[model samples]
Target chain A: MGQEILAIIVIMTAVTYGARVLPFLLFRNKRISGVLKSFIELVPVALLAALVIPELILTPTNEFTFINPFLLTGICTFIFARRVSNLFLVVLFGMVVYWGFDKII
Target chain B: MRVKGFIYGLRQSVTIGIGYAPVALTFGILSLKSGLNILETGLMSMLVFAGASQFITIQLIGQGATIWVIGITTLIVNLRHILMSFSMIRFFPGISLGKLSLLAQGITDETFVLNSKLLEEIPTPEERSNVALGVNIGAFVSWVFFSFLGAWFGNRLNINFSGFDFALLALFIVLTIGTVNRQNITTYIIAGLLAVIFKIIIPGKIYLLLSVALAAAIGAFLQQKQLKQNKCQGENS
Candidate 1:
């Protein structure tokens, strides 16, 4: 068990690191074009949206709904975030809203 | 100057560090229950440093998955970092390979978003490096420290941390809002719709990568067309 666990740890560490570092090494010499750079710049926005939207909209059982606590908090946070740039405040607001919804539903 | 930049980066990391505490602690507790010893649990957090993948790793182990299965799952789960690393290159021109390799180790989803958004506000390559390093190290240190604490004392702790997971989602919502503008609003909306759609039809983490790729490509094409149209309008005028 000991040796096997150690091997698993090493493999996970190496594989995760390899996934992250491969791109930086691969693109070292290549000069990215303007069009490509614009596309790349948008990746972060796209990635973030893709990451949070589904989780907010979908329940654990994969049912989609708009009135759930998560999505409601998401809407509240979006409105609050638009007005407030401070992340701490936005998060606090979200928690408060989520907690409120949790109590009701 | 370097210290100042690093400190600035650390300051930026405080929110994320706070956000990571409950999740990392949870990871530690779960890893131990899944049959990993304290040392093994801590080592996994120290080395893997990826939150979701680490959780997935332990769960798979509990299910008696093969090492190859765990390895492949970890790879696919973390493949998003490749796109992140590619996007990060624009900020660190002329950075040494050694430093880039070290930096890549810290490129989790949260840190990637944080650095990408905040690095633009900073001027000078050196300051950017300092801030980026600060955020990464700060997040790493907090994650490891909490994981160790959880492994050591998690069973004794009585506090319920279920609510704090909202902090991460909250952080992402704010960052997503921060990145959206008239120019890229279409991109943002498209990405969100596609992600929800893909998660239904596609399995695993591949849907995330696919949504980002297709949405960004569509967004970029639209932006380029807009630019070209403006150019033609100017020429006609």
Candidate 2:
């Protein structure tokens, strides 16, 4: 049992680390081109959106309602992040909004 | 300066770590109740530090999923790190592969935002790398520590941080704010729509990959056309 668990851990570590490190290794010494640079800049924004929307907030039972706590929190974060420019406050606002919703609804 | 950079990095990482602590504790408790011992739970936390995948792994383990499926699922989830790492390369000066390997292991979605902003604001390479080192190491330590705490204590440690899970999403939301300029607004919106569409259609980690691919391709094409137009305008002038 211990051996099996150890094997699983090893495989998990290898794959996770590989995914993280492979891109850096591949582009280690190369001069990134103009097109590649433009594309790379967009990667974070595009990917971050993909991770958040639909995945984080699901419309439960085929209805258009914010089933996830993320809706209010996300809006709060978006507003505070622009206004305050403080991550700590943004998180606090998001948490309060989420906790408040959980209690109320 | 290096020391200062590391200290700053550590401090900022702690800020990010604050958000991760609850989630880590939750995972630990969940894994413990799911039949993992403290040691196994801690090892999973150490080896697979990625959050989403770790959560899925614990869930699948509870259901008696096979090792291959668990492993593949995790890899698929984390494959975004590859895109993230590629994006980060523009900010770094060429360093040796040995050091690069160590640094790359530390890249997470949150830290990518922090690091990208750090590079944009500061021109010092030495300080940037040093701070990044501190941030990653600090986040790594706290994450592992909280996991162990959760495993030993289990669900009894719950303080009802239901929405704290959104901290990462909030951070990502903040991180993505400034990237949308006039030129790229349409492309970003299109990409977001595509991501939603793909999520509805194929429905899995593939949406992450597909949306990122399609968005980048479309954005780059638009960028190319803009560049060519500017050149033609310059020629005509």
Candidate 3:
């Protein structure tokens, strides 16, 4: 049992590190072209949107819902964040909103 | 100056470090309940150091999944890191592979978003690199420490983390709002829509990479065309 768990750990560490380090190794010290540079610049916005939206809308069971607490927290946080740039306050407001919504929903 | 940059990086990571606590604690508790001993749980957090992938791994282990199944799932889930690491290369050019590789290990989603935004505002490459290092190490310590703490107290504490999960999501929301601007607004919206569409159509987590690639491609194409049009109008006038 211990050996099997060890194998799993080793495999996960290898693949996770590989996924992260591959780009750095491949493109090290190379001059980035305009197209690739634009793509790179644009990726964070695109990827963050991709990461956030689905999680907001989908439940753990993969059911789509509009009335999610997390979704409400997100909208509230977005509005609050526009007025206030403090990360801690924005996140705290989000948590309060989420807790409130979770109670009702 | 380097120490200042590192200190600044650590300060920037406070929100992320705070956000990581409950989640990492939850991860540790879950791992303990899933039959992993304290040492194993600590090892997983210390070695893997990726959040979502680690959670997925613990879940898979609970379900009696095969080793290969878990490995593949982790690889797919973490493949997004490749895009992040690639994006970061533009900032740290001419740095050695050894230093860059160390930075690469710290490229989780939270730090990636934070550093990408902060790195651009800072002028010097050296300071940028130092800041990135500080953010990475700070977040790393929080995650590993909290995970081990959770495992250590898993059996003793019965705390519920119901609303705490929203903290990380809130950070993402705030950062995402910061990234939106006139230039990338279209891409951002399209990416969100495509993510929802593809999440339904596709299996596993590959939907993330696909939607990002397609949306960013469209954005880059539009941007280049606009640039060319401006140049042509200048020449004509």
Candidate 4:
């Protein structure tokens, strides 16, 4: 099992490293299309939302629960995230609120 | 010269390292509970450096999923990094292949975010590389140390936690605010709505990849049309 795990880790590392390095190699000294550039620019924000929101809003039970602690904390974070602009504070606020709520309830 | 780069990397890494330590520690503990040894847990965290994919892979491994399935799922989940890497290629001009490969191991969401913003501000290839190196090394060291700590103390630590998972949610909120602009607001909304709708309809983990792909395609098409119209209007004027 240990050897198998090691092999898997090695393979994964290779695959991931290749993925990260390929773009730099391919695009070296090449001008990419403006349309494609714009698309790539938009990807991070779109991907971040796609990665996070659905998971945060949806509970493990597969039901849309409005009073869900995660959702409430997310709301507070969204409200404060824009105003505060401090990652540490925003994360702290959300985590503390959510943790407190979970413990209290 | 190398000392400057290394020092910059160390400083950036410390900030990101602190953030990753707790998260990776949790992952280490979880992996240990799933039957991995401390070394394996630490190795996984050190090599993968992608928290989400690592979590999913470990969870699947715990359920006795085949290695092939885990590999395919991780590849699909990590496809976003392709785009990320593509966006960041401009910063790699003078970097050596050996250094680049080592740095690639540390490219996570946080490092990508920090480096991208840093590039925009600094605009110097060398400085950008320094920041990337610094941030990644910092995150990597943190991840490794915390992962081992978690694995070491897995049994002793008992904090029943529920709400800390929302950090990603808060992160997205912050990202959304930063990226919103006059031109991209419509595209952002369309993409966001599509993702939500797809989440509701889709059955499993594939929705993340599918929604993002579909929305990006649509957003790109609209942006192209908008650029064309603006170009034509300018020509006519």
Candidate 5:
């Protein structure tokens, strides 16, 4: 890689690492308030929603749902994953459903 | 009895490693198609280590976007790390700043989930940190390795990666379902709808942060309301 690409990677790493480390550093020894804890507790679900909803449905950019059987794909994946016990198997089932739906549509 | 936290962490994180493989392979293939060399692809996986941000970065780079665009956008997209790390503060008490920083580098979504769930199970701080390091290293190696594999053989391979995209959605579904106990179904429903609405309206990575903030506020509000009601019942009694 050239200096430019290396520089971009470095900058990306720096900012990401800085963000990840900031909370642990700044909030050291401080009491986390109840409201703050509640909010933080809620974050994973909210962020996951923020990510999945957009991508699964009408995404802003280059959405595969355009040509693909978008809703059916999601439904089938959801149902198919439920029957599987293993995480890997669930994901594999979802992918299979995705491909099957894509072909049908 | 033998206690091996690092080995335990590795065993626990093997699932995470497997989960990351398909997506990371797709990332490698995408990066290569986006005109990145094998070195650049591997560097992005090793350094950035963020799934969504790296994907967006590749798309932007392919579009001849500026460094500022990629940098700022990826940083914003990954802002939720602040919340995740904040939640982990009480779990990692009394650790040195340097070690904390090192552990923070290894925290991905999978590791964060694993560490939070297993923190209470592992009593000793030393063991806990060791396991966390194991999870981090395991996932990191898996990601970088698949990325290199994809980049090296991208053009020579004839694979349809469209199905691979479902892995991301499947991950979110599993995570969300894991949280869908009787306690907070309403929160999930409202937050989920709000996220969709927020995305449709805003149509950028910033919407992700906005939606999370708003939905988390809903949770906070519900908690406050319940607390106030408890106080009222106490006063009446």
Candidate 6:
């Protein structure tokens, strides 16, 4: 079972690394348009939002809950993150608030 | 010059490495709890290195999904990195193909942001690549070490922590706030609203990719319009 899992990890890693590395190799000498370049630049931020919001909003039961502790903490974190540039403090604040809320309620 | 660039890169990498340790450690523990052995858990982190995708993959695997299903799901979840890699191509024009490929493998969200910002400060291609290499190696080392730490200490420690999952979400919120500027705020708002709306309507994992595409399209359209308007104003003036 462990070896099988290891095999799976190896396969997935190669696949993912290939996916990331192939593009750079293929497009190394090619010149892309400015418009396309701008569009690609927007991908990371959009992808980050997509990755984050759903997990925060959705309950384990699969129902959408807006007033959840996670969301509240996220909003607080977002606000603090804006005001504070330090990653450690921002994460610390969010974790404390989140843990406090979970314990209290 | 190469030595200096390498040193600077190493320093930046160490900072990112420290940042990634806790999260990867959590992933390691979660994988162990999911019935994976220490070796399997560490290999997963070392190989995949994608934080959210690995978490989701482990959760699915723990639920008894087949390997094929788990692999495909992880691939789809990590598809956004392909787009990220494309955006990063311009930064590595002068580097050798081998180094560029190695650097591309390390392009996580944190590394991408750090390298992009570093490029602004260090206009020289070598310096920028150094920062990218530094951040990547730092993150890679931290990920592997903490994951092992989590796996090794998994059985001994009973950490009954809840709400710690919000760390990633909180980090994203902080990053989003940091990245938004006056010109991009409108794009950000539109994307945020559209993502929430799609999350309501869409059924499953499709929402993740759909919202991203929609948001990027919206942002690109707005940016192009603004650029054209500026060009027109310049012509008229």
Q: For all candidates listed, what's the TM-score of chain B alone?
A: 0.95, 0.90, 0.93, 0.83, 0.84, 0.83
Segments of candidate 2 deviating more than 4 angstroms: A55-57, A60-63, A66-69
Give one digit per residue, the lDDT tens place, for model 3 in B19-71: 89988988999998988988998899988999888888888999999999999
Q: Write one digit per residue (lDDT tens) for candidate 6, span B82-152.
A: 77788777777767888888887787776776565556567777777877787787778888888888888
Residues A53-104, model 6: lDDT tens digits: 6667877655778887888888888878777887767777887898877776
User: DockQ for all models, in order?
Assistant: 0.69, 0.62, 0.71, 0.54, 0.53, 0.50
Q: Is the docking of candidate 6 incorrect, acceptable, medium or high quality?
A: medium
Stretches off by above 4 angstroms in model 5 are A59-85, B1-3, B33-35, B113-128, B161-163
Residue B213 in model 2: lDDT: 74
In angstroms, the error of model 2 at B183 is 3.6
- The top-ranked prediction according to DockQ is 3
DockQ ranking, best first: 3, 1, 2, 4, 5, 6
Docking class of 2: medium
lDDT of 1 by residue, B1-237 (tens): 989989988887877888899888888899999999889988999899999889998999999999999999998888878888888888887778888888898898889888988998988766888899999999999899899888889999876534576787888988987788898889989999999998988767777888998898999999888889999999999
Off by over 4 Å in 1: none
Q: Report residue B43 deviation for candidate 4 (angstroms).
A: 1.2
User: Candidate 5, residue B192: CA error in Å?
Assistant: 1.0
Residue A75 lDDT in model 1?
87
Model 4: residue B37 alpha-carbon error in angstroms: 1.3
Per-residue lDDT, model 2, residue A15, is 92
Is candidate 1 or 6 superior in lDDT? Answer: 1
The residue-by-residue lDDT of candidate 2 on B1-237, one tens digit each, is 878888877876766787888888988988887778899999888877888788888888889888898889888888878888888777667666776777887888778767776667767656677877887887888889999998888567648657676666776777677655787776677777887777777745567778887897788778988998999999999
Best by lDDT: 3
Q: Please give, for residues B1-237, the per-residue lDDT of candidate 4 as tens digits.
A: 756766866764454665576687788888988888988988888777778778888888789888888787778767667777777776667666667666777777677765665566665676777777887787788888889999999568776665455554555566667776786666666666666777688755556657666666677788899889999999999
